[model samples]
Target: MRIISLISACLISTAASAEYIRGSDYGFKLWEGAAYTDDESGQFSHCVVSAPYKSGDTLLISFSKDKTLIVGVANDDFNFDINKNIPVTIYVDRRQPIYATAIPVSSTMVTLSMPNFDQAMHYIQMGRTMKIDGRQFSGIYDLTGTKVALERTYSCAASYYDYASAPVQPDAPVQQEGLSKTALFQVATNMITSIDVSDAKYLSEAEIENLGFGAASVFWQSDDLGILAGTLTAHRPTGDLRATDSQDLALMSDFCEGDFASSSQKVSHVEGVSQRELRGICRLDDSETQIITTKTDIGEHTLYNIVFFLNTEKAGEVKRAEATGNIAIHAASYAIE
Candidate 1:
C-alpha cells in the first residue's frame, strides 16, 4: 500500500527544535548494515545499510527504535534547505508510484518515512531496482543485498528492544572508568608539536570517541583542502598486527572502489620506536584519494596510528601537494614528550 496520507503526520510528530546528534559508534555489522546509537543517550537508535551508486548518489535504508522505517537518498551535489519537506515518488520495478514527502536532514540528504514497513520491505527485496523522483532530482538504485540488510536491521532492532526491556540488576555497574578523556589528545598533541592547524576545525573529544576512535584523539578536518588528519591509539596486540602487502592493497581497493595501489616502507625511528609508513592511491570516478599512514608502537600495550587522507575532487593540485607534505612533516616530527 502507498503511504500517501502518513507523510504529514510523520513529519509533524518527528519535527523538533532540538538538534539531532547521530552516533557513529556501531555495535555490529551484517554485510554493509550497522546499528548505531544516540550520541547523547548512548541508546540504540537505528540500524542502517547504505550503498553508493556509480551516479554518485547513495541510498540509505534504516529501521529506527520507534518501529518506523526510513529511506534516504544523498548526493554531494544536492543543496537542499534543512528540515524542508519536498514531494517525492518511489517506484519499485514498475510498481505503482508510492507518494511520500522527503524531509531534508542535511544539505545533501533527504529521508522519507515508510509507513508500510512490511510491504515496503517485500517490494524492495523482490524488486531488482528502485527509483526515486524528487522535485529537483531523480535516481535509480540497485537493490542488491537489500534483503539481507533489511533482515539484519530488523534483527538488530529487536535485539535492542529486548535488551532495553530486560530487568536491571542491582549489582550491575552503570559505567566503567578507563583512561582520562584527554589522555590520548594530550599525548598526540605533544608528539606533533611542530604541526600547526590554527585554521583547521578540531573535533570534540566526545565526537572523536563517538566515531569509534580514541577519546580526545588529535583529529582535524581541513575543509578548504578536503583533507582529514588524525592520530589514534589503541591497545597493542599480543601478536603481530601489521598488515600484509595484499591486505594493504585490499584495504585501498575497498576504500577507492576502483583502481588502487598500496606500498609500505620503513621510516626513521622515532624515540626508539620503529615506524612504518604506508602509502596508498586510488582512482575513483571523479576524484583521486590518497592516504598516508604511519604506525608506531608507543608505550606498553599502546599502538599509535597517524593517518592523513586527501581527496582531489575538492582540492587543487597545489593544495594536495601541500597537504601531503604536511603529513610527511608531521610524521617525521612526531616524538613523545
Candidate 2:
C-alpha cells in the first residue's frame, strides 16, 4: 500500500489552514507524503506518512510539533460530522485492545490520539496488522513499513527540536576516573527533566545524603501514589564483564533487603546501549513490595541503576508503562558525564 493523490486531499481537508512543505522518504513504501506548515505563520505544524488501501481508505500517522501522535483514517465515500468525537478500540495483532477517542477532523477524516506512546509504537513495530473498531467504521490495515517509518519520524522530531544541540552547563562535572558526586547529581537531574516528571517531588541533595544511600543517588517520592523511584550509579572496574543471573540476583539483593522472588528478567537495548531489567516481588512478614530495577553500562567502567519501589497495595494504580518508558528514556539520554 502506497500513498498517491489521496495524500494531498487528506492533508488539505484535515487542516484547512495548513500548507504542504517538502516531502521526505523513510523507505519501504513509507514516505512523509504530507509535511505541513501553518499557512499564516509558515512554521512547521505536523508531518504525516500514509498508506492507501484497495478499499479506498487511507491510514495516516502523524507527529505534531507539540509531540502528539495521531492515527487517522480517510475515505472519500465517508461523510462524518466535523469536530465530532467517537469512541474507538484499536487492536494491534493479538495484543490487548487500546480504547481511545477519535475526533473527526473533516467530513471524511478522523484521528485518534495515542495515550501510551511507547506501547503503541512497540505494538505497531512488532505487529503485522492493526484493526480499528468504532461505532461508525471498522477496518484492518497492514503495518509493513511502520517500524522504519516511526524511527524516521522520531529522528525528524529530534532534529526539529534540536535535541542534539541542547547545551550542557559548562561547569557541569564530568566522570573521568571515578564516580563524582557532582557529576552523578547532574546526570540524575538531566534524566529527571528529560523524562518530564511533573507529579513527583524529588529529594534535595542534603536529604539524599542524609539517607545514607551513598553520594551517587537521586530519589523522588510520589506521596499520592506511594511510589519511590531513584537512580544509583556505581563505579565497577569489570570491563566488558556481563553479569550472570546469580550475580544479578546478588546485586539486586543489595537494593532490596527482603527475600526476593524474581518474576521476570530481560535485556533490552536502545541506541546501541544494553540494559538488563529485573522485576520481582519482595516479601517480609506481612508486607510485600514490588521492585523494578534496570542496570546499564554507561561507559568508562561505570554502571547506572534505575530502581523503582512500588507499594504492593497501590501497585494497580501505578502507571507501570510510564515508569518503564522513563527508564528507557534515561538509558538513551544518559552520558558518562
Candidate 3:
C-alpha cells in the first residue's frame, strides 16, 4: 500500500498535478486528485476512485465535490497519440459496449467523461471484468470491490464539507466481542484552517479535514472493558515544543506531575519525520488508570498531541488499540510535508 502511494506521487510529479491521496475501505479505491495553478497555488480538485488492470493500467471514475461524475483511464506505459476526436469503447462485464471520446493527458495517459457514470459503476461492482477497445493492448481488470469502495470513497469525500457546515456525529458503535464500553463525542471542525498540500499525489478534501490544521478528533469505547481512547487537534502553542533540554524537561515534568501521579518524562525518538518530542507516562486517579502522552511538532507551530488511557484490567485490548492509534497518527503526521 505504501509503495502504491509513493509510485503515485512520482507519477503525479512527472505529470505535473495537484496534491492528492488514495484511500480504501472496501473493494473500491479512491484517489483525490488536484488541479493547481501557475502560481503554485491550488485551483481546484476532486475525489476519484479507479479500477486497475492486471497490466498496471487503471480506469478511473471521479466524483467532483461539486456533485459531478467523471470517467477516465490511465496507463503509465502508453505512448498515446493525441487527436481532437479519439474514439474509445469501454466494455464492463461484456455488456453492450459504451463509446466515448478519449482526451489524452500525456504520452501515457488519457481520460473520458461519460454521462452514465452510475451505470458504469453498477457493472464494475458485480465482479465483472472491465476491458477497453476490445482489450487488444490492455488486460482485463476485476471490479469486485467497486461497490463498498465507492461508498467509503464518497463518504470520506463528503466528510470534508459535512464537517465544515456542522460537526459530524459518530455512527452507531461497531460491535466487538468481549467488550462492553462505548465513548462518543463531536469535535468542532472550525479549529482546522487548511491542509498542508505538498508532494502529495492526490489530496482528498476529506483527508485535508483530518490532516495538519483541521479539526480532527476521535472517540471510541469498549463497553465490556470500560476502555476509552480519544485524541484531537489543538491550537498551536506559543512556546517552542522542540525543547528537550534540561529547562524544557523540567517544565514538562512539572506539568505532568500536576496532572498525573508517579509520572516519568523523557525525550524519545519516533521514526519518520524528524522533530522534537516529549513522552510521559503516569498513573491517574490513584493509579487506577495509565496515561501515555506524546507531543510532536509536525510542522512549525503545528503540534500533534496524542493521548492514551487504559485500565489495568484491560491489558489485552491495549496492544490492538495502541497499534491502531499509532498507525493513524503516523500516517496523518507524515503527510504534512
Candidate 4:
C-alpha cells in the first residue's frame, strides 16, 4: 500500500481514470488500493478518490446507502478544521442519512448526505460542485496514482412516497446476525454494495456470455417491500478468477415447510430457505429483515432473498433463494458492474 501527499504524488489527468476499478463514485473502489474496508462499526463504508488533485479544487458529491453521501476529492487523506463560530448545518455526503447537523471534527460526525436524495433518485444530470476548502473544483486531476479520471457530471439521487403498506419500515435499521465467514470476509472488504443479480441482457446476437455472466446493480430504491434490482451481464470471471457477491433481491417467494427437512430449516418457513451453516434475521417493526451469505460443498440447497418493495413507497421482507456452488459466486460483494 502506498500513501503520498498531494504535493509528492504523481500528477495526472482528471477525466475518469481510475484503472483497477471503474467509477470513483462513493461506495465503490477506485484505483488499485483498498476501496472498501471495515471500521469499528458493523456498517459497511467505502471511499474512492474523485480524481487526484489539490485541496484548492472542487469535490463533487452524491447520494447512496439509503441517504448516505459521497464526498470525493483529488487529494491525499487529511482532516478539515473549520471554525465553529462561522456556520453549521450537518454537511451530508449527498448520499446518506443524518440525524441532525453538528459542529464537530471527526469521520463519524461527517454526514454523508449533501442536502437531499436517497437510493432511488434516478434523474441523472449534474449538480452543485463545491470546493475542497469551500470553492469550486476546476475539474482537474492534480495528482496521479494510476491516473484516476476526473468526473464531469456531479449527481444526486433519491425516491420516496406515502409508505404506509410497508411490511417493514423503510428507514428502520435491521439487526445483522449469523454472518457467514464468506459474508464476513466480504463485509470486511465493503463488498455489500456490489452484490446484485440480472434480468438477462445479451451483448451480442452472434455470441453468448463466455460463461453466461454479466453485471447488475442494487440501489436505494425499494422494490415496494425492500431494495433490489437485478440485471444480466456479459462480464464475469473467466479462468481462475475468484470472487464473492451478495445479491440483495435474490427472492424465492413461497415454499412448503415440508419441501425441506428439519435439518434444512435454517430460517422461518415464510422467510424462505437458507442452506449454509450461517444465516441471520432481523425483526423490523411488524415485518422481518434477513441477510445471509455462505458456502458449502454438498447436495442442492435453496436460499432466497427478496426485496418486496413498491416503488419507493413501502417496504417488506425479502425472500431468499438457494444457489449453486459456482453460481453462488455471484453472491460475492466485489463483482463489477
Candidate 5:
C-alpha cells in the first residue's frame, strides 16, 4: 500500500494567503503552502511544490506517479487560457535560456514538462532564481530549498517503482502458439515512411501532411499523446524477445517521468500466444493523453512493436477497437506469409 506523506498537517494551507512552511518526504522538500493535494494513503500519489511571487502569482512544481514533473505558473487575475500552447524560456543563473512549451491545466495555470529532472534540479540547486518568460506572462521564482524538494520528489518516484527495493527477476520466454518462428518475426527495417491520412484511422486526419511519419524514433502532436514504434534485432540469439522488448519500452516510457502515473506494463496470454503491453495516462492541458504500446514476436531474431498516440478526450472510447490493430496485424501477417 502507498502512504501519502503528510509530515505536518498543521502546515497545510487552504488558501494562498497562508504562510508557506517547509515540508519534506523521503529526501525532497517543498513549501507546505505549495502542495495542493495530498492522497494521505501511506503512498505519495501527488507531490506538488510551489512558490509565491511578488505579483501574488504562484509558480508550481508537481510530481506524481502518473504525470510528468511539471512547473506551472498560475495567476488569479490574469485572463490566460491553458487550452492553447504558449512558448516560454527558462533562465537559470547565467546559463543559456532553455526553450519549453507550456500547456494550460486550467484557465490561469500553464505548465511545462521537465523532461530532464536531473538537469533542472541541478540548475535549481545552484542558481539564485528561476525565471519564466512567456508571450503574456512572466515570473521569477526563488530557488531556496528547491534542491531538497526535488530530491524528495525523485525519491518518491524511485520508491513508487520499487526500483531500489525490489529484486531483479530473470528474463522469461513468452508463451508461443501455432505460428512458426520464421512467421513470428514480423518487423522489417524498411518501414512505410509515408501513410495516407485516411489510412491512419486512429490518428487525426487534420494533421496528415504535418504528421508524416518521419524517420525519427518518436512523434508527438501538441494536443495529443506521442507515438513511438520501432524494431530491434538481436545480433546473437536472445531466447526471450518479450523481456527485451518490455525492458526497452520501459526505458523509453520512463524518459518522460510523469508518464508512469496510472501506468502499467504486463504480459497477457491469449489463445496460447503472449503479448507484452505497456499503457499509461499522461497529463496534458485540461486533459490527458493515453499511450499504449504492444509487442509481438514475428520473425527470426526480430520483434514488432505498435505504439499508439491517442487523446483521452477523443479516442477514449475507440482505443480498444480492432481498427487500431488491423493495420499492424494484417501488414505483419501478410509480410510473413
Candidate 6:
C-alpha cells in the first residue's frame, strides 16, 4: 500500500523567460484542490495545503529541526507550476554544491505535471519494506530550491495498493491463520482490526447538535471486538479525504539535523522517504510486526537515533484528537491459526 506523499524541488535557473525564486511570492487563488504528477515516475497525488491560497501569497520555508529540508508553498497554494515562482537552495550533509532552482509550484494547487532531478540529492530515510532492491516504497520527497521556497509534495510509491477498483471496504475484516501469540500483534492483529475505521458515539448532546461540516471516525466495542463508524465533515474541502488517507501513507518526513531537543519537543516522529534515510531503523522481528514502521512529527530533528513504539490492546474506545496528537494504537486479537 502506498502510505506516503512526495514533494519535489527541482533546480530552476532563471533566464529572461524563466521564473526567479528571489524574494518573489508566486501568489495563488487558494485552489480548492491541486494535483501533481511526477515526470520521472508515473506517481500522481493531490492535497489541500493549509489555508491562505491566493496569488502573490507568501509562506516561510525552513528545514525540520533535524536540519532536513523540504519545499513548501503555503497559503493553500499548489501545483509545481501554474502561479507564483519562488527560489531556494537545497543542501545535504557531506554534499557539495549550492544547487539552485525556482519554486516551480504555484502557491495555489491545480492539476499539474512537473520535471525534477537532483544531481546532489540528500539521503533521507529509506527502509520501510521487506528488503528487496526492486521493491517500491511510498513516502514524501522534499526538494528544496537552491534559493526559493515552495510547498511540499506528498509522494507515494509508484506501485501502491491499487484502489482503481471501487474503494475496498476500509472496514472489511481480513483473517489469517497459523501465527504464534508472540508475533500476532506485529501485522495481522493490528491490520485485522484496522480493516475498519471503527464506530463513533456523541458522548454528550452538544456534540450531536453541533455536529456538521466535519470528518470523524469513531471506534467502539460491539461486544469485545471493535466496530468503526466514519462521518465526513462538512465545510471541508473535497480534498480532506485525500489528505486523511495520504497522511497515513505520506512519504514526506519531517527531517532535521540535531538531537531530540526541548524545542518542538511535541513533534517527535515523522514518516521518512528520502533515498538516504528511507530504510532507517531495522525491525527487531517481522513475523511479529504488521507494518514494521512508525510515523512521528514532533521533537528536535537532530536525534542520534529515533524510536517509535507499537503495541496492541483491546478496542475499549478509540477517539480522534486523542492520544496526545500521537497515533492511537488500539488492541486487536488476531484469528487463531
Model 4 residue 156 distance off true place after TM-score fit, in angstroms? 17
Best by lDDT: 2
**Residues 66-170, candidate 6, lDDT per residue (tens digit)?**
223333343333344434443334333434424344444433422111123323322212211111011111112222231211223221111121112122377
Q: Quote the lDDT for 33 in model 3.
A: 29
Residue 107 miss distance in model 5 (angstroms): 0.9
lDDT of 4 by residue, 1-337 (tens): 2231121111121112212112112211222221221222222223223333344432323222243334333222434342331132221226332222222222112222233433212211221222122221122222321211112111111110111111236787542223233443333222223333222121331121111111122212223344432222111111111111221111121111112111122222222222232333444345443433333221111222222222222322222343322224443322221
Winner of 2 and 3 under TM-score? 2
Instruction: After superposing candidate 5 on the true structure, give the runs of residues whose Cα lies further than 4 Å from its correct spot.
Output: 1-30, 33-44, 114-118, 156-337
Model 2 lDDT, residue 102, Cα: 73
Q: Per-residue lDDT for 95 in model 4? A: 30
The TM-score, computed over Cα atoms with residue i paired to residue i, of candidate 5 is 0.36
lDDT of 2 by residue, 1-337 (tens): 1342344334434444555442222223533343455555555655666777888888777776778776678888888887578888889988999887777777887777667867886898778999989888788888976765665555444333321111337897653443355655665565455444556777885665443343346677765555666666543334442543344444345445578787445555465665667676778877877667666666643345454555666556556657565665565455423
Rate residue 309 of model 2 by lDDT: 54
Ten residues in a row with the worst lDDT in model 3?
188-197
Which candidate wins on TM-score? 2
> Which wins on TM-score, candidate 4 or candidate 5?
5
Clashing pairs in 2: none
RMSD of each: 12.7, 18.6, 18.3, 18.0, 18.3, 18.5
- For each candidate, what is the lDDT? 0.54, 0.59, 0.41, 0.25, 0.44, 0.24
lDDT (Cα, 0-100) at 116 in candidate 1 = 71
**Cα error, candidate 2, residue 91 (Å):** 1.4
Q: Residue 133 of model 2: what lDDT?
A: 90
lDDT of 5 at 5: 21
Instruction: Give the winner by TM-score: 1 or 4.
Output: 1
The candidate, 3 or 4, that scores higher on lDDT is 3
Candidate 3 per-residue C-alpha lDDT over 1-337 given as tens digits, one digit per residue, 9 for 90 to 100: 3333333332333444434321111122332222212113332234455556667777665554466655556677877665543666777875877675566655656666444766765766664567666222444566655654455445434433221111235895432221111110221111110111122122233543333212233433344443443333322213344442232233223323335433324333454544343344455446544434444444422333333344566434445334434533453443244
TM-score of 3: 0.40
TM-score list, all predictions: 0.40, 0.42, 0.40, 0.24, 0.36, 0.24
By lDDT, highest first, what's the ranking?
2, 1, 5, 3, 4, 6
Name the 10 consecutive residues with the lowest summed lDDT in model 2: 158-167
